[model samples]
Target: MREEKDARIIKREILPYLAPGIAKLLWGKDDKFFAGLEEIRLRIKSPLILKIGDRDYTINRRGEITTRLDDAYVVEGEDIYRSIASISDNSLYAFEEDIKKGFITIPGGHRVGLAGQVVYKGNNICILKNFSSICFRVAREIKGCAKGLLPYLIDKNGQIVNTLLISPPRCGKTTILRDLARMIADGIHIPFPHNVVIIDERSEIAGCYQGVPQLEVGVRTDVLDACPKALGMMMAIRSLSPEVIVTDEIGREEDIASIYECINAGVAVIATVHARNIEELERRVLFKELLKSKSFGRGVVLSRRQGPGTVEAVYRWDD
Candidate 1:
């Protein structure tokens, strides 16, 4: 109870700081969402905790995530706990199912979230289930995202030809990739654009929903969701035979190995890694496989001063 109260206070304090896009999402420019959410507060029962735009409230029941739709969730069933209704059945399976499927849309369009046991096989995540808290980090789309870095990358062909973008944490590597993918797939005046295969490890790119992409990427792009980079690269090489391979945040042992093979196979690679500066990045052992001290390929560095996805610097290999 004490913890929940603390969280509520935090929620209120942070409400004013939501991102521009996210603020529009939950509350809308007219504040309709905010008002709608407020009215829904009256319906929540016990055991269900609700955190909307500026405040946090709790439900009186366990299945409140679904029941508290006006503000946060849209309930799927009766107020009574179905799993516990059977007397002998104590498992909260029914309630858990709704929680997994429902989304937590916070005020800034940022969403915090919860889930059940993350089912996995080897490195593959099969599914997520059960439920507790939910948080959506918030989603934003930047236009002309890669325009700043194009000059350093594009060649006589007008296309980047071959290049890599590097960044640390939320520096916008993926955003650049998304714009580049869209631009490339559309066959920008930049010469012959070829097919692109995106190994989206986290369904963020192209955000395919109902078989369609929630995010705007070019038409010629194909994506593999949740698969590791190496396996996806190998698959693209064989099946898609793409002209270029693009992916985000690469630096694993397997990632280095796969990229090396891709380079050897004569496939151009566009990838990013979490590094502050090239000097700082070279220290990482995995990079040795892709970048040699002076003979490294071109790279784009991102930093806050440069802007959210600002291009800090570009490096070209001695080769």
Candidate 2:
């Protein structure tokens, strides 16, 4: 039943934005196939590819997975154009700003990455044109995924601790962060519900589309979609008065400055970074400084040994 629901979600949320022929090709795939689907890539004059886990598989015209490149369906320029049109609601101009950023967040919180000719305005990007490749990254909401980490994130006083989640790319850092936000905001294992704010720089945490979250972040959560981390943290502090601020992929110096500001304001912060382990994180100058400051009360390391979001270890920094 879960697989069936996942398949339905993909069909309803992601397929419509794809080219008609491509959508038709994927529509007939079995529920189990869709349940494990992670990403879909379409490149002009290239074979259509589907990513499941860490492996990529080519798809044939008959909606079946194939190992032969010759049997795989080749994407075309027309398909790319149609897909762009569908995703943009036929008004590509309206999404020009997002397109300029190389991706757009669709209704289901799924992100479609675009790559093509870069139109430059002086030193900055003006727009993207003549799309050649589109990668659809499916977003899945795995509620309660962060349940085990709650003990490490909460203190004896029931207050949420300043936590950092460390993981490499595609290891479910965002997914875990999302679930943590939900659990903390909803007071799942804490004393009571608290105001949670998500600084969604890339719209990946809450997967907000048009100022509303498409995923289940929580009732007490407020999201700042597509906003810079530093600016969003200040905004949440000044306006939202969040008790807990959640953000992903924080390593920039400016981000560190904002984290200190959050700490001074007595707001708990839950953030993630791309690091294989604590040793790797400590090796980086910025992260080393962060560790020296002792800003994070706890650190949780994740990996893909068992699967994405596999918690390898949790460390209490204050200890």
Candidate 3:
């Protein structure tokens, strides 16, 4: 189902950016390599590593299994150059802003993590130059992954509820957020579709390529790709008239204020934050006021105990 779509992204969207030798190695490894692949790490003169599930494996130049540091292919500077060229479509200036963000979203919603020297203009990061590494993160859309969680986010009136998804890094908060957007926007089991606006500050949620979402968010979803969450949320409320505004990883003070504004305007928000559990989330200084007010009606905590997206517990605010 949805798993098959992600596999195609790797081949059609991601493979073209890879250097010839590395791509060939990955291709020769079999479909399992692509199926299980989560990340591909390429560093200058370093081992070519692939993250599969929770484990990492080093592959040699010939795509053979290799653990020895010396046996692994030493990624060169040219490999990075070619990758940047392919990801940016030979127009690096067009993606200059994304480069400053430390990543670029290519054609298939996949993100390429950039690393190199920081060029600063005053206190702000102007750009990243002399790139030495590229980490490919595969974008996956589990169509019905959020189906089990949707019931908790709805009331008897069939209206969407304000919810927050809490999870630590690499715990699939963005993935769940993306799926939820699709369901809410397209009206999975709901009687009517809710207008969903996604504030994709990192371009990870919607994976917009050239302003068009590469991932299937939904027919009704509106995405403010690569826009700051605070500004984007305000913009969505002011213009898009969304019933549910979805965004990832909200923690900053401005983000909190924007959420309040959205709620005040009668818009439900579904956002993610970094916390192990509700207790940890409440303890944080930035989240204290928001938690105290119970602005968010429901909170879902995720953990890696049973792997990413494992819903450990659900908390409801009694208001």
Candidate 4:
């Protein structure tokens, strides 16, 4: 059943964006290979690479994994062009804004990261051209992943405390945050449901594609996809009247101010940041004031020591 699901994901979500021959080659691989798949990298004039778990492997022309560089399948420029065409639906101009942002979020919440010549309009990036490499980062939803953290996040009054999730990249912080949104919206482990709003700056938390979430974020959740975090939080407060606001990777000065506004509005907040531990988070100039003010009632540290989403420690600021 797992293999079948994995195959279906690769077929529906991944293969369509690959070149025809390359897609056929990948489809021939065993289902188990797709099960642990995390990323697929396509580079012009380079070997096809796959990142599974913590290790990287090269794919040969025969659809087999090999360590020998000479045995690997060399990706051609045509493959890159064809994949880009497919990803953009043959209209690259239509995705100009997304391209400028360096990635395109496809259906199933998969993010295709682009690399090549950067086009500049004045001081800001105008667009990307001469595409040379693309990375497909798979987004997987794990329901009930936040169960263990419920006790730490929820207060005795049955309301969620202002919380911050700290983790390094690829530690499943986004995955855990997604599940936390769902559980909070659905009233899981809580007394009643709350109107939860997700400020998805990168479209990672809700995995929203074309303004609709591809992942399950509960029946009552509202997502503001691709909006700036600080702006989105204020917008949600004014229009959505959300009881709780969730966002990922909040570190900017404006983000801190907006979080303060949310607190003043009597809305709970759940946000994530990139940090290996509390000490590292404190060393940052921006977060110092937030920590001193005790804006977050609880802080959860996550790591990949056991696996992705592993909870390392939970700190109570009020203590």
> Which number leads on TM-score?
2
TM-score of each: 0.63, 0.98, 0.95, 0.97
Model 1 poorest 10 in a row by lDDT: 79-88
Sorted on TM-score, best first, the list reads 2, 4, 3, 1
Error of 2 at 61 (Å): 1.8
Model 2 is weakest, by summed lDDT over 10 consecutive residues, at 60-69
- Model 2 stretches with alpha carbons more than 4 Å out: none
Model 1 C-alpha lDDT per residue in residues 128-157, reported as the tens digit of each score: 644322333434445577765655656655
Root-mean-square deviation of candidate 2: 1.0
Question: What residue pairs are clashing in model 2?
Answer: none
lDDT of 4 by residue, 121-194 (tens): 78999889999999999888888899888878888888999999999999999999999899989989888889
TM-score between candidate 4 and the true structure: 0.97
Candidate 3 similarity to native, TM-score:
0.95
lDDT against the true structure, per candidate, is 0.57, 0.93, 0.87, 0.92
- Report the lDDT tens digits of candidate 3 across residue range 140-212: 8777888899899987788888899998988888888999999889988677899999999999998998889
Q: Could you tell me how far off, in angstroms, the CA of residue 10 lies in candidate 4 after the best superposition?
A: 1.8
The global Cα lDDT (0 to 1) of model 3 is: 0.87
